[model samples]
Structure formats: C-alpha cells, structure tokens
Target: MKKIALLVLVLFCGTSNAQKKKKSTTNPIVAVIITKTENLTAEVIKPNFYIFRNENSIKKDTLLLKAFSSSITPTDCVIKKFVTKSTPLYYVSWTEKMNSETKLKKETIVVTNVQIWNPATKMQVFSNTQTSTNIKEQVFLDKNKTASETQERNRNEGYNFTLLPTGDFTLKNKAVESKYNLNTVTMKYELPQKSADVSKSSKKKKK
Candidate 1:
C-alpha cells in the first residue's frame, strides 16, 4: 500500500511538471538596420526580426492579427508611405499546431523593444516597454456546423515612440513602467566625419 501511494505521488508530480512546461511561452524581439542615411532622412537596408517558439504554433486565420509601428520610419518611401497603415517594420510572432492537418499557426504581435539602428550614424532608436496580452481565438467552420475550437494564449507585444529625423527616436513609455529603458543615456557626441576631396579642385587658379 505504501509503495503504491509513493508511485502515484511521483506520477502526479511528473504530470504537473509536464503541464507547466507545455504552457510556457516565448516572446519575439524587433530591430532594423539602416544602411543609408543622408541628411536627416534615411533608408532601412535590412530589418532583423527575432521570434521565439513561433515554429510550433498553429494558425486558423491570417487576418486575425493587428500589428504596427507606433511611430513611422525616419524617412518616407516612394512605394509605401509611413503612418497610413500598420507598419511592417516590426514583427512579433508565435506558432501552434492544433492537429496533423494544421501545419503552423502564426500571430503577428509585439512584446518588447521596437528598435531602429543606423550604422552610418551609429545611432539607435528603441521602444521602452515590455508589453504582453492574452489572446483568445474561437473558430467555427461554416461548412461543418459542429467543427470548432477555442484557444486561449498569451501574446507578447510592445511600445510607442517618437521618431526624430536627426537619427533618434523617443520612447513614449517610460523604463519604469515597461522596464525597457536605459539607466545610462545613450551617448551621441561624436561629430559627423567631414569628407576629404583628393581630386583636383574645380576652382581655377588666382592667376
């Protein structure tokens, strides 16, 4: 009797641990790389987005997500203008699988720093927030009246900011509230390098 009780207790503990592990979630981080910066305006050469645990998620709808940049990019684009639509410069996502037929589900979300870095100026802009929200999704198939699923999930997402044309942006959310601010201010004291001309001067001689 004593042996049977101990085994049951062990099994219970193991099951609880497994359940907790299954419920764990991971958040994605955001970033951008600006390859060009002329005057105050700039261009993003590449954007780097890092997502955690998105590979294992399942999706029933692509239009269910709402994500955007709290502020526009420092410069304007010819094809698409900023601030009109939810910007795609930042991304946060996670994946889930409901069944074998369900490949992978992705949610467009945000949970942390939204950053833009200009390597040319060595200037970086970032959001100051650690934000998260709970997501509940219920799907009902029109064709199959009885087919449906309800899912409750935690989504990580992020902050608001002010983009400065001078290669800087101000975060609307404070570090204390979001715990995403720096104790030490970011230094940008370096003066822009002056160009040197090796070619012959266009100016004619005084003679």
Candidate 2:
C-alpha cells in the first residue's frame, strides 16, 4: 500500500512539473544582418537595423559588439560574413507553405529568407532562414489582413547579423531590442593600406 501511494505521488509531481514547463515559453534569440547591397539604391537604405534578444523582453546589444570583435574569411560565408572591413549587411525573406497538405482546408507555414552582403567586396556575407507555424502563425501574420479575416501575406523580412567573435552564435530574444537609431551608429571603413592610392583616386574622380 505504501509503495502504491508513493508511486501515485511521484506521478502527480511529474505531471505538475510538466504543466509548469509548458506554461513558460522560451524567447527567440536572433541576429539581423543589415546590409547595403549594390542593388540597393540610396533611397532604400533608410533605417537599417540590427537587433538581438533572448527569450524574455530583455535586449542584448552585446552581440553586435562581439561580432565586431570576430574575424571572418571568404570561405566562412556559408555561416557568417567577414570578408570586408566595414558595414553590416544581410538578406530578407518572408513566405508561407502548406503545413499539412491534403484535399481539404490546408494548414500553412510561414517562412523568411534573407542575405547579407558587403558592399566593399561586393560579396554576400551571410544568410538566415526562419519559419513560424502552428497557432503562432496567426500572430506572425501580416497586420494588413483581408475583410474575410484571411491573412494578407507580405514578403517583408529582416536579416540577422551573423558575425561573431567566435564565428558562431545563437541569438536570444530577451537580449535585444529592435534598433531604431540608424543615424547614430558610426558607419565607416577602415583605412586602406595606402593613403597615396586614395588621394590618386580622389584626384581622378575630380578630373
């Protein structure tokens, strides 16, 4: 009888623990790679962004600092970009798919793809892909929905900055906040190997 009671108590404890865990959600951590692609005209580069976060609401700006400290090579483009001396560049993507395709009403999936590029090298540096589905799809849905309440889909997407001191990272949603101060961020290039060449280029352009 004692053993039966203990077993029941243990089962109850386990079930309660599982319920508690389900109630809490982990925040998404991410790095957005904002870039000025060659195709991007001056007008489109407005309010570029790079933000990081953990599961909670806490913002993590340190990821940007760490990325600056990391060094990237040409080959590392598969995961992150480091070929250039300056500028944060990335891709944008947003789409949806049938979550469970069948004859009747089809479920859907939301997805986004983005590419990061370095203007100086004219090479893509990093790209990130993400998907959100299930009940969250309704929340992820675009605000501009149709009158029938079907989601009005838009392809607008944001990129994650992948450069890190270690060349690898998993952003936490609680660590970052959306960046809105683009004008304040210092955007400049490292000095070239020779000043004379710069002067010559300037003179030629003037002529």
Steric collisions counted per model = 14, 38
Model 2 reaches what TM-score against the true structure? 0.25
lDDT by residue (60-85, candidate 2, tens digit) is: 32122112212221111222333333
Distance (Å) between predicted and true CA of 68, model 2?
33
lDDT of each: 0.35, 0.38
lDDT minimum window of 10 residues, candidate 1: 76-85
Name the lDDT of candidate 2.
0.38
